[model samples]
Structures are given as structure tokens and as C-alpha cells.
Target: MIKTTVIALLTAASLAGVAAPAYASAFGDVSPEFRSFVADSIVADLNQKGVHATSVEEWGDLIRAYVTNDNGTQTMEFFTPGSLQPVTK
Candidate 1:
């Protein structure tokens, strides 16, 4: 009986994780595969430009990147979605 109870509790705990909601991106309505592809492209381009880019994501209709600077500081940079051009204020 004790073994059965322990197993039941463990199963429930594992199931709770599976039932949890996935983290949503800004463009959650769009397909995840497309978004991943775009983000990956942006990362690759930025790295090629020697930007030291860490990660990229879609944010509010723009592509946002986390970049590390030569001074060891991190900053957020915005870019156009398709062209991947830097967006300046």
C-alpha cells in the first residue's frame, strides 16, 4: 500500500510539469519553427559582423538581440524583422 501511494504521488508530480504552460514569446501567435529560424539567422549574421550577440528573439514586431560589448557589458539591440537591419532611434 505504501509503495502504491508513493508511486501515485510521484506520477502526479511528473504530470504537473507536463501540464504546465509553455513560455510564450512576443509573437506567440506565429509558428515557433519560423520564429526559431529567423532568430537563428539573426544570431548568425550578428556573429559574423563581430557583434558578440548572445541570443535573439521577436519582440513587439521587431527582432531583439542581447549583445555583449567589448567592455563586458550586455545591451539590448533592436532590428528589422526580415532585413535584420539595426533599428535606430
Candidate 2:
């Protein structure tokens, strides 16, 4: 009984891992053109604000921006999909 439970638990965990990406993708993947537009707009806007944003890309249901700081270090910032507002933890 113990062995069977362990195997079942392991199988369930494996399946969950496999399904996670598909579940996230069900949120909808934007087209290449839309992604490019978002990236370009974010880069321009952030740079204008002096954030030194290097690039941006779609990350699951959010947008991830690569930023370089004045101290010569890099960091990642996440934003909402449509509104482009920063996501707070």
C-alpha cells in the first residue's frame, strides 16, 4: 500500500509539471506583431523615463523587461499585459 501510494503521488506530480505550461498557455499567446509592438513600446517608454530598459518580451501572462541600471548591473521587471503597469510582489 505504501509503495503504491508513493508511485501514484509521483505520477500525479509528473503530470502536473507537464500540464503547467499548457495551462499557462491557455491564457492566450499573442501574435508576433503584437509582441513586437509591446516590446518596442515598453522599451521606448521606460527609456524615456530613465529606467534604461534594454528589451522586453512576453512571459506567460505578463511582460518581462530587461533593464540595465546606472550602477552597471541588470535586473528584470515584470509588467501587466495590456496596461503595462509594473507588477508588485
Candidate 3:
């Protein structure tokens, strides 16, 4: 009886886990083209700054570009990738 109870509890837990809501990413609003443009611009800016970049990634509504400076230190920035005119903070 104890074994059956434990199995039932485990099955219930598994089912509950499966029924949990799937996470939706916040980046659903931005288009792929815009993201690409933003990433490209960031890479260009980094290059201008004399930073050697190896990769860039788009996460949700932000673009993270990784750059390696001459000193061999890696850095990243989160920017909203878009063609819209830049806004002042």
C-alpha cells in the first residue's frame, strides 16, 4: 500500500509539472530583421571602438554583443535593436 501511495504521488507530481504553463519570451514584439540590424550596428560600433568581437546574440527584446578588447577582456552590452531614431536617456 505504501509503494502504491508513493507511485501515485510521483505520478501526480509529474502530471502537475507537465500541466504548468510554458514560459513565453518577452522578445515576441521585435522582428527578426530589426534584430539583425541592431546586432550589425553594435558590431560595427565595437569595431570602431577597437574592440574585437567574436559573437553577438539576441535575447528577447535586447541584443547582447560580446567584444574582446586589446587587453583580452570580454564585455557585453544590452541594447534595444531597432532602426528608430536614438532616444536620450
Candidate 4:
């Protein structure tokens, strides 16, 4: 019984891990063009802010732009890339 339970749990966990990317892709597809646009905006904004942005990475429904500022490193999040609108509080 214990072995079976462990196996089942492991299988479920593995499945969940695999499904996570798919789920994220589906949600991210809401606005692929928008997301890309937003990401570009973010980079521009960061540059104006005197920050050097390395790249923009999309994970699931979130777009994270990494920047290196004079103070330190920072990450900006946007719902869609095209809008470049900051996620509302």
C-alpha cells in the first residue's frame, strides 16, 4: 500500500510539472503579439531609466524583463508585452 501510494504521488507530481508549461503557454497566447510589444516597451523604458536590460523572458502568463541599474538588478513585470503597461496593483 505504501509503495503504491508513493508511486501514485510521484506520477501525479511529474504530470503536474509537465502540464505546467502547457498551461502557461495557453495563457500566454492570450496576446503573443501584445506580449512581445510590451516586452520591447519595457526594454525601452528601462533604458530611459538609465538601466541596461539584458533580455525579456516569458514564463506562463507573466513577462519578466531583467535590467541592470546603477543601484542593482531589477525585474519588471507586464501582463502583455504590447501594452507595456505595468501590472496594476
What stretches of model 4 exceed 4 Å from their correct place? 1-51, 74-79
Query: Relative to the unseen true structure, what is the C-alpha lDDT of residue 64 in candidate 4, on a scale of 0 to 100?
Result: 62
Candidate 2 Cα errors over 4 Å, as ranges: 1-34
Worst 10 residues of 3 by lDDT: 18-27
RMSD of each: 12.9, 14.9, 16.4, 13.7
lDDT of each: 0.65, 0.65, 0.50, 0.54
Instruction: Sum up the clashes in candidate 1.
Output: 0
lDDT of 1 by residue, 1-89 (tens): 99999976865564345211211333345467755644555676678777788998767877789999999999999876555678999
Between candidates 1 and 4, the TM-score winner: 1
TM-score of each: 0.58, 0.55, 0.38, 0.36
**Model 3 CA lDDT for position 36:** 52
Candidates in descending TM-score order: 1, 2, 3, 4
User: What is candidate 4's local distance difference test score?
Assistant: 0.54
Q: With candidate 1 superimposed using the best TM-score fit, by how many Å does residue 72's alpha carbon deviate from the native?
A: 1.2
In Å, residue 2's CA in model 4 sits off its true spot by: 73
Scored against the true structure, residue 68 in model 2 reaches a CA lDDT of: 94
| Pairs that clash in candidate 4 | 34-81, 34-82, 35-81, 37-81, 38-81, 38-82
lDDT of 1 at 64: 85
Cα-based lDDT at residue 74, candidate 3: 84
